[model samples]
Target: MTLKTAQNIAKQFTLVKAAATTLLALALSATVMMQAASGASRVKDIADFEGIRENILVGYGLVVGLNGTGDSLNNSPFTEQSLEAMLERLGVNTRDTDLKTDNVAAVVVTATLPAFARQGTKVDVTISSIGDAESLLGGTLVVTPLMAADGEVYAVAQGSITVAGFAAGGEAASITKGVPTAGRIANGAIVERELGFDLATLTSLRISLRNPDLTTSRRIAKAINDFIGNRVAKSTDPSTVVLNLDGSKRDDMVDLLTDIEQLMVEPDQIARVVIDEQSGIIVIGKDVKVDTVAIAQGNLTVRITETPQVSQPSPFAEQGQTVVVPRTDIQVTEDGDKKLTVLNSGVRLQELVDGLNALGIGPRDMISILQAIKAAGALQAEIELM
Candidate 1:
């Protein structure tokens, strides 16, 4: 081939290789962006909408059908009084008769009413014995009206009690498993009313972050705005984000929430190290860091002993008398020589842990050492003692 033809061929090959390299770079960039997006979380998983919550409902009730472990009516006057009142309502005169039975227990029932819950919707209820009843297993809760804090009845609960634990024994010895006095009734309470707010009529909505962080709040707002292709979402503070809904989307509030809640956003977290002294548990976060610090551990032991000695003079000496004297001895010792080991500056949690582990220290000693480092401003994370 001619020299000019060979040069042209080389130029063509170079152009093709450059195109391939550019395509590979673009592909890698896209892959990285996709991976980052996959690791992000939805807005609803990290934040809760304002004014949308559960309401607590509580009520006093009675449980019947227990085998033989019921509250003593004599000791629990309220239990007897409640039973008497219930019986009187059922067209029975129990005031004259000494109604003594071991098949009844007084219980406090509790349930939660979800927001926008309609009438006739069932909710789970929990029953707890308020008296000295041994167990609530196999008991059936009576028809009890659950009331909210506003003194209005919201639901009625009634069903067979299902206890997670059991109690069995005699007067001298007994064995109990779990908490026998507490039980639950699934789908026991029916909603009698709904809340006052209407979602379709709402012009604005707000989200409250579980953990308040300025960067997270801004990112959430930006993600929502970008997803909707408008600047409708705004971060009001570190914990709150407010959104303005257009008139066209007001009728489709459910659809709007569905889209907004699914948008992904990365969240920020504080570096923290949590320690449970009782359980000797140490949890170090990945972002935790430490500066150069020295640690030394030592143990001191003390021992004491007592001895009684008898002193006697000559048996026939009138001026001498037998006597007893107490003698005591004390000893103290310390193990291991004191040596301060200098730990290099650690920029990662693993490095700090490795340095601490090299000292052959336990969790309790690690907790003390971490606290000392934090106090000395060597640790770059917050220390939480549990």
Candidate 2:
């Protein structure tokens, strides 16, 4: 072949290779976009159905069969009264009798009655010592009636107390872990009445978002409507999404809710920075942005050390006496080597973190710097101190 024809063929092959590479790159980009879009959360995870919640039930009771770690009768008069009343209920009259018992403790029992709980359902209960009891370990809670806010008994709790903590001590000191005064029993309370709500009779349902955001609520409503092929879901507020079951295509609310909850929708969140000062924890959201700002943080450190030297008399010295001489050493340091880190305008969360990290700033100092940036109106996100 001629050298010119060979050169032309080589050029054509090179062009073809470049075109194939471009196509592969475009395909990879599209795949990444699709994966990112599919990474959204389901509707059930970010929101809760309105009327479906647990009710708090509380009761006062006595925990017996403790190992001499119960309430002192002298200090806890309520314990004495409760003991007498309990004895009377058991057909043993102990009125006006000197009752000295170190095995009984007055306690408060608490449990949560779950939503749609039937009469036979059993729920977990927590028992806490109200008197000055040393521990509730190895104790059995007496029969107690758990009541709701309206002062109506809904369930009865009586079981062995399972304390997660214990205390052991001598006359000198004591050591304790967890909370010996509190305990939990799995399935200790039996539900006696139902919460007076029927989910099947509801014509409409309200979905309350755990995190209130207008964009998220609207997105959820849109996703529900699109999945059902009807405009039955509407965002009434930032935190509420109302579903019009009457206008929905499906007549069964259960099936409709199941379908709606399984629908995946990308939830939006506000740009927020959370700072926990006590624990030195700072969390910056992915959407957090920062305007153009320069931040410089430095610390002044001063250290003082003390040393004492004893000056003793020599063997031949007649008038010299022993004495202690105090010596102190102090050192001061200033971090003047740190330079100002200038964050550019519209910098995202990663860039902001990188800029801060470049200054060798720790979490505690970064919290103060973020607050300062917020005060200066340079941080384009809300700072929530927790």
Candidate 3:
């Protein structure tokens, strides 16, 4: 059915009513597999293409052009030194005189040169102040050499910085938003060299798991071995699966990788419930199965409140006499008693949500409930908290 039809039906009939009288009873619903219900996923969704990756490059540079919000003269010596050297390069006489600069800041620029990027390619660069600078708005970066991890200059960065924010006023009173000292310039750097890789010489391929699982690794190895009709894949660990296409022709190996990647294998992750206490987030993996157990969750909240009051002197006692006082109060409340919920044998996903909802606990409360269950050996799943 189309989404519009489903929405109309959902609007007319509540999910609970439909579940009891119509939804699950429909034969069509049995054939449809929903991703949310089961964590069954595609191979391509979790594995990366073997030889594809990005290269990181960094460079040191200077940002100029600020009315007075730039680095302070006495604090940032690098700013003063850079300004003097720049003047000398232009044939302008720069002497032993002390320099005071409030329009420049020393910064480190960085960018990720993507795989297969050609020469003269314009890539974005991020500039972060290595020195004290109030803001980088309207600053222009001088040409600076961008180096890779090997210490080779692969690109040169030079552009007018486009700061998306600003800072104003003096030390006493200032209004600022965004990162004043750091900013990004789009298409700011030009790539001068290219990275090379030997694709033809590749004999073995690797399948790296996004989230490692012993069961999933075994399944991946079995799937590849089945497709290639030989023992072509081996699991180095839970995360790495190596595919050795030895004795196979180069053309045949290319075809082999294409078929192996498309082979569908059910990835198995350990049953787990993840919680983010700060955001009150709950994630339940498909394999999460709870043992038959009973649970009750409750919460108590205590709040303190303060109200200020003013006391004035009685008539003619002391005309200007006054005192400050506060009226303090406290409130305590215990939430409603939660009835014990029993987990049936082989409980399903819907049963889990329904059982939790019966307790009338919010996401934050549910986190504590799951934690208690895990501690009691009732929850047969890993409990992760952030």
For every candidate structure, what is the RMSD over all alpha carbons to the true structure, in angstroms? 7.2, 9.2, 11.5
Provide the overall lDDT of each model, using Cα atoms, as 2-decimal numbers.
0.88, 0.92, 0.81
Q: What is the lDDT of residue 125 in candidate 3?
A: 96
Q: Candidate 3: where are CA atoms >4 Å away? A: 1-42, 82-95, 169-174, 247-260, 301-332
lDDT of 2 by residue, 167-256 (tens): 999999999998999999999999998988877777799999999999989999998888778899999999999998876867777778
Question: Tens digits of per-residue lDDT for model 1 on 1-386?
Answer: 99999999999999999999999999978966884776678788999986778999999988999997789888888999999999889998889778789889999999999988999999999999999999999999999999999999999999999999998888999999999999999999999977788776677888899999999999999988887888888999999999888733346666788788877788887899999999999999878988888878777889989998999998688898888999999999885765667777866888888778777788888888899899999999988888
* Candidate 1: segments with Cα more than 4 A from true spot: 1-39, 247-251, 301-339
lDDT string for model 3 (272-294, tens) is 88899999999988667778889
Pitting candidate 1 against candidate 3, the one with the higher TM-score is: 1
User: Against the hidden reference, what TM-scores do the models get?
Assistant: 0.80, 0.88, 0.76
Evaluated at residue 238, the lDDT of candidate 1 is 97
The per-residue C-alpha lDDT of model 2 at residue 38 equals 67
Ranking by lDDT: 2, 1, 3
Clashing pairs in 3: none
RMSD of 3: 11.5
| Order of models, best TM-score first | 2, 1, 3
Using lDDT as the measure, which candidate wins?
2
Clashes of 3: 0
